[model samples]
Target: MKNRNDKQGNLPPEIPHKKRFIIFLSVFAFLSVAVLIRYAVLMLRPADTENTGNTKPFVERGPILDRNGRILALQTRLGNITVWRPDIIDRDVLSRDLAPILQIPAETIDARIESSSADFIYLKKQVEQSTLREIENLKAEGRLRGVGVEAIVGRIYPEKRLASQIIGFVGNENNNGLAGIEYALESELSPASVKAKGGSGNQVFLTIDSNVQHILEEIGERIRRESRAEAVMFMAMDPRTGDILGSASLPNFDPNDINSSDDISRMDRPAIWAYEPGSVFKVFSMSALMESGSVNSGTVFVCDGHYERISNRGERVVINCLGAHGRVTIRDIIIKSCNAGAAYAADRLGADAFNELLQNYGFGARTGAGNPGETVGYLSPTSRWSERSKPTIAMGQEIAVSALQMVQAASAVANDGVLVPPRIVSRIVSPKGETIRSYEAPEGRGQSRRILKAETARAMRSYMVDVTSDIGTGWRANIRDLSLAVKTGTAQLIDPKTNAYSPTDFIASCIALLPAESPSLILYLAIIKPKGDSYLGGRIAAPPIREAAEALVDYLGIPRGRNPQISHPGSVSLPLPISPVVDAVVPNLEGYSKRELLPMLLREDLHIEISGDGWVRRQAPPPGSPLNSDTVIILELE
Candidate 1:
């Protein structure tokens, strides 16, 4: 409302140019101070924002050990080299220094440091300690840019190829578990650290005994070499508890370099592959008969080498008998491996009862042993059975079974009619050596089912022992000091295209229980498609059984039948000095039977080659020369 001159007068007059500049500078200084105070407060306060990116490296993984506390697998510290590209002072100099130590191309290192996009890049992982030391020396010289090393856990196997399939292996990234126990118990064995910030690590304890595993692998290798078979699988278990002591499959791959192996060789054959078990299956057929109360061990049947079909399907199935066994009891049938006898028994016990008994024995079913890729063998339903199915199945054809199933089923018989579920993992121990989890032996099949009486098992065991004695098919499996009860099987492989048996290919198998009366150990060995030799199980598989039994007896320290009398150092020889048998030239014992050669060998106190069936064709230590008592004589048979 006032006059314009009066309102203008209320405001100060315009300053000189220099004075105005000072005023402007004063305002800018105040604004700058305010900005600086805000920035300082922001920097001084703790960051509320989460890091979102974690930098601390991995914690160590624990060990995988066998039942004997032997290290099967372990994790060791390894060095990984990484670079901070932005921090790299001289890319060329760094490349020059690191190229030789890291064994990487110099160009690769130079390119990595020159790249503007990467904040951090890995140069090398799992570098050995020695290589890491070399890299550190370059870093001290100020020529290795921003390269830094972090310790990482690397998986390692002490026993290279032993039990490779069963133990499995880890992978490239962080050495995480990939297969076998590594895959099965990944979470439990690799737990997050207690800090809840890194990888969890713990020890996994397996039921496998490393010593037993070594023995099994050694014997399996021997069998594969001797039989020249396509593949061989051997497994041993504690019959009382179904604890697998050892499992070995030939053509094994070293887990340390698993990438070099084929997928087939990497598979755990004993648990994965299924086959048509031959005469060895007679035990189950016989058990089915006894379980149904239709027959006993004394049940007898006449065997004329073949069984004619009574059903109207016009299916005439031939039951091949090893020899003409006359009227034979169930025990005799099993011991003699008479196919006709088994067919008769299956016919006597109807299909329904037979199948039920098989089911009760845990056949045609998976054992659920917690192994990866376990096969539940094929067992056709009752409705699907053909007219010849009964006899064919009784004679060990048609039904397919995994080696693990055979072992588990036999465990029932060995455990006195109570089946115990097999297990590979014994327990899980924490990193602190405290037990985190313990696996107890699982109970047998069903609560109400009883497959056979204790007396029946004992009687069957006796008959089984007879099979390894003079009169039965498994006589070749006899051990020197231990009693071996074994059954031999030679299964014909069916050609899918022809829908018929292949003449040349056969699966030779032998299953034995040592100390036949009360078996503590049960062993099963199978040689698939053996070549360049006799394919009979008695010839190819029995010898391995004997070797395994002998090795096991020594390993377990089982008291020998008769301990050798210890001689005192100063003890004198008998008054009448026993005349030492004069060394004689080795004899041509080819084509001679055990009976024919026994007396001669005893008279000369000579060691003899007495393996396989039939007469010998070749002999070691040519005949008619002075032979020392310590000399071993080899015999060849045609």
Candidate 2:
């Protein structure tokens, strides 16, 4: 025992066990205090931590604008009314109070709260600013404890039903695009930068001019209503750049009121709907045949009302014609839209060769125009062709096509042999209007594909010009003093139940090129299953084409022929009317040329209807008239 005590004393001075235990406790307590202080420092600090320094605030979705910079679709700050069940002091009172402000039934709100499985339920979504203000006011007064308005960015279409299918609608929950250009360019339109530096998505500018679109819609609506057609698609394009100027599909729905519309009304018919185009396709067929050296301008065929073909199976195949035309040349085939003559011309080429030529014209494939649900339009391959397929396809039977495809195919003739693929989106730009990306067809992709020889295209245009003459099928499409090349089609609709062409139902369609020698515009109109006394394309569709051309000619300032130049006095200086008026009044627009008032046409706030072409001859609002949103500044030019 002595040895153990002596060894322990030699090691160190002995302290009380209680003192040693207190020392350890004090050390631990000091460390705990230090840790608590550190935690408190971290907790009390601002959220500018190293990790959070790079975090970005949420950004709003960008706007979709027309080619003229008119807002088609834009995001608005919308509030969604939500209910927290646990926080609700009085569910009955909350529901009753919220009902009228939300434009909802009180009983319905009450029923929703009672039936809800979730503690939190959305009472109403997309609450207007006025409505949200009311709810917010009540909440400020402690009237609504559980009822909260959560802020959300929502899409709003200011133009309503105008270009609805082209702009498309987003999902209610995630705001993802469901159709049209929205769906096709989702990444470009959505605020994807929220994950990075946080900025608005790139703005998409379409090639469609709102004024031109309005004109087409006005005409298409009239055609649909007067003809009692099932549907209508009227589209216009610049043949040079393939920029779609206007596209209007009837039975259009307002994107703001999408829930009230169905899929049929929402369909982008010009891009998505595919049907068998009749004689209008003859132009393409003849072009293909002519390009292959199978037919020429001088080549002639005899027609006895219908085309007769002998199949390998010893079957008689017949494709009827609109008229007998005793003898027809390639020019007559196009001018008269003679199906028998077209079939005879097609017979000169082999099956594979004919199909290949048509395929080169952007048939049997998507035009890559950036439409989401665009159909390839059923053009069967040579392998799938029957014995009667050659002649049948020649006269625009059996093969199906879309209005977009028709426009794209016709560009070859209009562009003097170059095929320009249709492009709806002109460019994608940043929120600040900086060009993010410019869109154009890639090389080796029909950007410069000469689908026809220059001579062949010229010849084709010349033949199509005759179609607008008094003797041709498209004579009704002619405009006085303006050279127009036109093609009219009246195709029979196929009955789904019968799997054959419907006897009563027909599609009346027309395609026209203005200033036939050097076309600047191509207009296409199709009225499907038109119910009327007359279903001929010339009678029903051609007149609309003429009306559209006449308006477009004056609106676009296309030269109606060479006019004598009138010299203005050099001493007389007049300021160009840029802004309408400082007070939003209709200024003195008289004596100003049509070009002077053009800038006013682009204003979203003003609706100016200009008729005729020279200097301003008359004004509706008069000088210094207060211009409101509904004010129509009518300018008549001479």
Candidate 3:
């Protein structure tokens, strides 16, 4: 070294300078490596960012409509109030501001904000648009912190409880189908909506006619009021096609608020509940005999109003009838509703043959009507049948059937022995308005079993008509201008504990086909546990059938009376009586009490105006005229 002291005093040597440069290069390399490693780590990490900030919240579901294009169920957008705890600036202030507006307690808001476990929470769900707008105004002014709105889809029912049991309701989470048509057509009714845009969806079409449904409901309500029944179920269908036109079960609830209703209220009774069909089963019994080639419509039997059987166990079963008929033909049996005659026919057909007929009619099997909770009614197996079973079943005792099954079976008679399946949904359309699928009327699905001949059906229909005419038990069911064929049934409900009929408890029912010659509509009515005067089907159920028929005839515009040109010359013509003419001064019944005006109007034969419950207030054709007996005066009251 030239001189260590001299080099130290002046500057660093050449070798020391080279060493410092090496140290600088090494530090630069280490820094570059560290930066590269950090870059790789960030690229490899999973993207788990919260989706709370996503613009669209929920996807829309499909719409369900009735046959006439009336919307039954649909989806609509609703707002929800959400909160971000971390962004909240003044928790105490926010709590007080939102408590009353959101209907939430102040303490609840405070606790939610203090919860470090949750990044966000909901303040309220499905708030109305108006209410949400008010909250948004507050949020914009900074009075509320971390609060935002999200749009969500919810199910809506326009007609409330009109067809709740058929249309069904939806669940909250994701708007899934819950019951009725919703459950039956879940996949179709709940199709995926357009990609996250929350747009409208596909449409599902049903076969129910809302007008016919209204008529049925009105008739059922009237029956409930008149009979004071525990419950009433009325159903009408095209018996040839198995297309249910109208169906109603009393004590119905609105599906929009289905959660508030009891489970029993939601149960669809027509497809779910099974009951003894009473004498209505006699139609099937008579058909079974005719189908077996063992009996004809002219076949006669004696009925002493009781049927007795000696069982294999030495037990005697005594079955009582409604009345005594000395000798009755098959037609007469149907007319009088003779239980003994029906039991005798069952005895002639024998147990195995009769059971086969019952099974053929879909009594023990599901109707496959695409309904939820369909019941397979009671029918004893061939091996388990007892001697008493035959007689009891003959009079509609030992077997049970759902209302749907009864209607489906009757469809055979109405369709010339061709059995068709029943369905509610008519077609399903995609969101783009393309038809995806359609459900046709129930056909036998390749099963070639024929129950009755066309001729037999015609004969049976003729006999059923007599049941509604002057000489039958169901005379009350007669419609003035329409030919109605109906059968009335009054079955005694057996107490399960005693295995005997209860005197006071009865199930009154009627099954009818209108325009008997070429029936288009078939109706069935059942009133359970009616409380008022009579328990007979004629008195309790027949009038409802008449009312329903009258409404339907007026609605459908079915031509009244047969072709006049085809009438027989010697047909027993009844003379129409003409009322006597009255010429008198019209009475000023206005402002007069109904109690005071009744006697004066009746004595003078002058038309009177009566309005309010208390008294008449105003009248037309004022107080005097040579009043035409046929003219009716107008009245107004307060």
Taking the tens digit of each residue's C-alpha lDDT, what string does model 2 give over 1-638? 46786766653354577678999999999999999998888788865452355554556677889998999998787788999999999878987888888878999999999999999999877766778899889988989888887776678788999888999988885358888877878888888742313557778999989999999999999999999999999999998888898999999998876778998899999998889998899999999999999888779899999999877799988888877987889878887889999988988999999999999899999887877788899998789888788888887889999889999999999887888889899899877778978886534344658888877787788677777766788878877667788999988888999998899999999999877767899999999988867898989999999999989988887777422221232111114545536247778877866433433543456687877765687998788878787887888878
The 0-to-1 C-alpha lDDT of every candidate, in the order given, reads 0.76, 0.83, 0.74
Clashes of each: 5, 0, 1
State residue 8's C-alpha deviation in candidate 1, in Å: 21
TM-score for all predictions? 0.71, 0.72, 0.70
Model 2's TM-score against the true structure: 0.72
Candidate 1 per-residue C-alpha lDDT over 271-348 given as tens digits, one digit per residue, 9 for 90 to 100: 888899998888777876776778875687887766665567665656677776778888788777888888888888
lDDT of 3 at 275: 89
Q: Which ten residues in a row have the lowest lDDT in candidate 1?
A: 563-572
lDDT of 3 at 479: 71
Candidate 1 Cα misplacement greater than 4 A, ranges: 1-54, 79-152, 193-199, 443-450, 562-638
Error of 1 at 568 (Å): 40
Model 3 Cα lDDT, one tens digit per residue, 336-443: 888877777667776788788778888998887767888999998868877778767867887889989888888777766766666677788877778878775455
- Error of model 3, residue 523, in angstroms: 0.8
Q: Which stretches of candidate 3 lie over 4 Å from their true place?
A: 1-57, 79-151, 192-201, 311-315, 443-449, 496-499, 562-638
Best by lDDT: 2
